[model samples]
Target chain A: MAAPPPAAAATTRTGALTVGLSPYTARTSAFRRAQICRHRLPTLRCRRAQPLTAAASSSPVFHGECFVVGENIDTDQIIPAEHLTLVPSKADEYRKLGSFAFSGLPSAAYPTPFVAPGEESSRYAVIVGGPNFGCGSSREHAPVALGAAGARAVVAESYARIFFRNSVATGEVYPLELAEAGAWKECKTGDIVTVDIGKAVMINHTSGKEYKLKPIGDAGPVVEAGGIFAYARKTGMIASKASA
Target chain B: MTMTEKILARASERASLEPGENVWVDVDVLMTHDVCGPGTIGIFKKEFGEDAKVWDREKVVIIPDHYIFTSDERANRNVDILRDFCMEQKIKYFYDIKDLSDFKANPDYKGVCHVALAQEGHCRPGEVLLGTDSHTCNAGAFGQFATGIGNTDAGFVLGTGKALLKVPPTIRFVLDGEMPPYLLAKDLILQIIGEISVSGATYKSMEFVGSTIESLNMEERMTLCNMVIEAGGKNGVVPADETTFKYLEGKTSVGYEPVYSDAQARFVSDYHFDVSKLEPVVAKPHSPDNRALARECKDVKIDRVYIGSCTGGKIEDFLAAAKVFFASGKKVKVPTFLVPATQKVWMDVYGLSVPEFGGKTCSQIFEEAGCDTPASPSCGACLGGPRDTYARMNEPMVCVSTTNRNFPGRMGHKEGQIYLASPYTAAASALTGYVTDPRDFLM
Candidate 1:
């Protein structure tokens, strides 16, 4: 396919940026254009610049610092019931919402805050957890809190089913199940990691090792569309499919 | 197919069912409480736009149970948001706070979502019920396929009145043999969870069967199904029997088709337990699956005892605890909180013109035993409500409770050690200030 015009390229790069599409082919309506970008551009800039597009990307890749967490890190520990209603009705109040992330965790449980106060600006793209991560309550606030606190994805040995679905449906955090046993042990806090959703692979850049992830199946499209609502809107399942 | 599979198939309008097959099932009732309701409403408006109307207002139930008693502006603000949404949407089933004059007044509240949903007949046989709270599985006692979903999914259901569900495999649990008087259904479920571990039945259905389960009343059956989520089960179902029908009689006019599993239906795993071998069990702190017999934890001292929640705050539970307290003939040795799950349950406990109480209710019985009965029928201290909640722990204290989860910080303090037990065990522990077996008090 021919390269798009520079104006179109700029628009695609900055506007209507769907997942897995390179800025060069942004105007192309063909689904195969996303596939082409996936194989050609190993280090894609789309996800890093636009996190919203990461969910529906044909080949979504996320790179970030890992925050190692232990098994059964429940919803209450992530964001306690006390802070559940801290949700902001407007964008300006998000910092207040993010401030309470992991506030519920006892100081003795972690050496430092999961996301320290005033450090919400610092990006912690990935959360690495042990078995049965997000085991308690079905509050989507756990993942919502993490997303607002600047997490792009989570790599865990296993996840509680409700948390896994909530993460996908909210398009808040990409939940990647680590297929390799003890894979999380190889990485430490502050270690940089890269997750390739299409290939189902995780590369720990700090440890210089690669780990496999379980296949996400049909749920991938829903996540890519930035949640079930977006997917339904795009597919004309509900009315007002054209509007955002 | 199992009863769960059959229910799913009928809701999805399918002739047969297969595990892991995603099908869109029509929802009979969708419930959301204060904590998750505002978020669901936000997503609903964002996805469907401001003008979009809910699929069916009558089918949606909104109960403001959690965090409603708090003076905190944010908690009260959540209820206001839900109230406004109900007013805007013209939804009639919104159970609002009845008495604003006193937060403790067992106001005109319906109760905890799970308990009220069943008690009010929203959970019908062969139907599908969804709630934003995880304990929504408590509705499975009525032989329905009930499960919890997130705010986004709930929002979708609000617009579509349907949810796409993957039919989960079923695990059969059969309780046989004679029952011991001291052991409640809570003990039996705790033992089952202990054996199964926390995630033993993740994404699967649990069907309780056999003569022992058959003998349990509707409330006992609800207690059995309420904690299935603790075991990572999608739902816990009991086949609708005469007891189920009797409970539903005159409560609802909505028609329902009872579902039952074929005699030879296959289950992924089957477990048989004899009630005779069971003892009063308590799930120790940090995890609901970490369980031991009440006698095993007898040495552990307790600072408080709580008898309430969707799991343990029902009328039957109150009666069970009252029986122990009446027998002890002593004031509560430790600070104890007595919460009835619903206003109806509260009225029953207080003997408020209830003929069955014979002029003496469990609340009166507990008052004589020096227990603090919070008048309002909300989720008091179950989800660790306001700071002044009746059973909230301020420091690293141990509490034997009749609630479901025993996770860290689940009941106010992170260091608080919570032991999950039946109301009988909770009442006995309240009298002794330690984790004592109910049998000791009864004997």
Candidate 2:
């Protein structure tokens, strides 16, 4: 649309070596390419063009400003039920959903919105939260909305079972647990943070603090490969969708 | 091994499996509704090819229940998406509701997926069921391994007929005592959630047992299992007995084998409750674990009463509400809404006579009590689908609802106040315009 940013062509060639993941391509074409890339979660009739290969998707690190929420932030608060009619698979609605992310968080308590009014995306690429985060309803929209809103990861004290699993399965957002408790107290909204999964620590650039994190364990590889379907395809656990 | 372990072991074709071991098991059924079906279908088509067939047409059940009867374009489009996908896949158990005007016009339409799943006999003992909706745990009433999964897992199950799952350790909730006519399964579950907080059972199995559970009916058992998700449980199970067998008879053609917890089965934790001593309970607004006794909160005023949802919308639940209405012998002081969980339950509300009311149907009792006409069976206002949904709390009024979870904005307006209660409590509160205990009229 906008003449495929110069970084788009740059990413295709050396995406594997770009650890920080150049903002332009990793933020857009990574998922857009998933639609046509046979190796990633196959989209409708996966295309055969210059595909965004699996190497481009396995970006091992994430760094951005963090939006923060409190304990027991249920799915309804993440993406309310009234907005669930939006089909996450459709590209346009997926972007529209990003605008409504965290719309349900009470305005009185959360004065700072995750996505500003009328904005399709958020300034934050990471979210910090308290215990029992994403604690209600199994709607994948909760994670999908966060990822669509440009959130790369959520570091929290703990997570609900279904939300954590859905995040890993969809490869929408990374759900990481902080080794030390009280991440909510230590972190605040609009904090600059960097998450290094391999190092198992989150660095708060704004506060000049470091917090240890629990490993993603078995779920890391799946999310890195861009959801379970892609991981299964790469590991030969399931056949490629295009060849099926 | 516990009953859950046995069922998981069988599903995975393993001799035995301990807690925390991840294993790939064959899924017996994969259910999706209007809310999640479209995304699941999209994923299935995407990953399996646009022309690919479902792994087993018979095993995939699609129910268009949520967001139905609403005029929202996207909501209606979601149902259309489900219909198109079902037609494309030749899905054997697609419950379609074409007539939004009159649900009766479409006889195959079932309102709520969980209740419909049980009535249609898709739930069986010792089998594994994975669904896209959170209340899929409701089917564990039949002593099965049933749990909710997101769309991605449902899509995977649709294409591969398998799910890689970690076996959850079982928590034993043993209830035993004499009959307590004042209490229902809703009260029992509320009491349990209060005792063990909302996330107490997260990532674990809840095995319900003892003479008290054995004495309840199948619908009551379903009520017990339905809200396990509210407690973050993987699933909740009650061993299949004569009650379960009697209910399943003539409902399904497939054979099923029920499993039981061994006498010395290991449990992560054990809780014992005496049913007779338990009081009617309600979970206050904003959270399901915010529990309070009904009698203690008698002064709290309410604007309306809603009696519906997978947790409390069965024929028996209506009958229980009717019993309270008939006992009070007074018109409702507040607006009261009734929504049955399925078409069959809807029929029963009008057809089956309430023995406590001198042989009158629940509809007749509701009419005499001056409550609103029974809306078509659906998930009405339980999670508040669209702004125009029937009886949705658009005004932020205080209401006593017979549904699970009163989380903020769950019923509609973010400021709305919802007190989750039993049908009996809902009916009693309807008569007084306040949170009244059923014991006042029943006793």
- The best candidate in terms of TM-score: 2
Residue B251 lDDT (model 2): 91
Worst 10 residues of 1 chain B by lDDT: B351-360
> What share of the reference contacts is kept in model 1?
0.44
In candidate 2, position A92 carries an lDDT of: 78
Kindly state the number of residue pairs that clash in model 2: 1
Q: Estimate every model's Cα lDDT from 0 to 1.
A: 0.80, 0.86
Docking class of 1: acceptable
DockQ of 2: 0.48
For model 2, give the interface RMSD.
2.0
The numbered model that scores best in DockQ is: 2
The residue pairs found clashing in candidate 2 are: A36-A47
lDDT of 1 at B341: 86
Model 1 misplaced regions, further than 4 Å: A1-57, A88-95, A235-244, B103-108, B352-359
Q: Quote the TM-score that chain A achieves in each candidate.
A: 0.73, 0.78
